[model samples]
Target: MSKVIEIQDSQFNDEVVKANETVLAYFWAPWCGPCRLVSPSVSWVAENYSDRLKVVKLEVDASPDSVATCKVEGVPALRIFKDGNMISSHEGAIGKQGLQDFVESAV
Candidate 1:
């Protein structure tokens, strides 16, 4: 099973912003092709770094409030949160290596 938590706008604060540990919030959409391409990397991070990071995915179309709050202009956006704040973000289809580096930079 995947370690990635499928979250919505209502759960964003509790799941990510208020969490005690580091968070990897993935913003995506069902119709976004790049989202699909980057999904594997996200999942890989979730599985491999579960001990240090909390991974959550929010569908852009379904979670408008979170999308707007995060200022996510496009799909496949990855935001790293720590101490109830966003520390880093990348908007695009970053491959597995890039995702690894991104997460490593925060945690």
Candidate 2:
């Protein structure tokens, strides 16, 4: 499977909450500045947690319906899921350290 998976509005229901293990979903958009800044950190955490966590990216601009459901107030919202349930979510850009911590706890 691919290292990074893109989850759109259509796939959100089936891929996210129903996932088998932990999920680090990055709700982002191309026009968002903070989203761009923290993307690499997200990717790094995803790679590091590959065995226990699943990371998916959702482009907010491309998925208005999904964004509405998430009710994201800002860019780069990181939601951690465990046992197919959202355990916690970190809003805004947490950079590398925060991302690593969130993923570590989720997994």
C-alpha RMSD for every candidate: 0.6, 1.7
lDDT of 1 by residue, 64-99 (tens): 999888889888899999999999999988999999
Model 2: CA > 4 A from native: none
Tens-place lDDT digits, model 2, residues 50-104: 8888889998888888677767777888877777667888888886987887777
Per-candidate TM equals 0.98, 0.90
Best by lDDT: 1
What lDDT does the true structure give each of the candidates?
0.94, 0.81
Question: What residue pairs clash in candidate 1, if any at all?
Answer: none
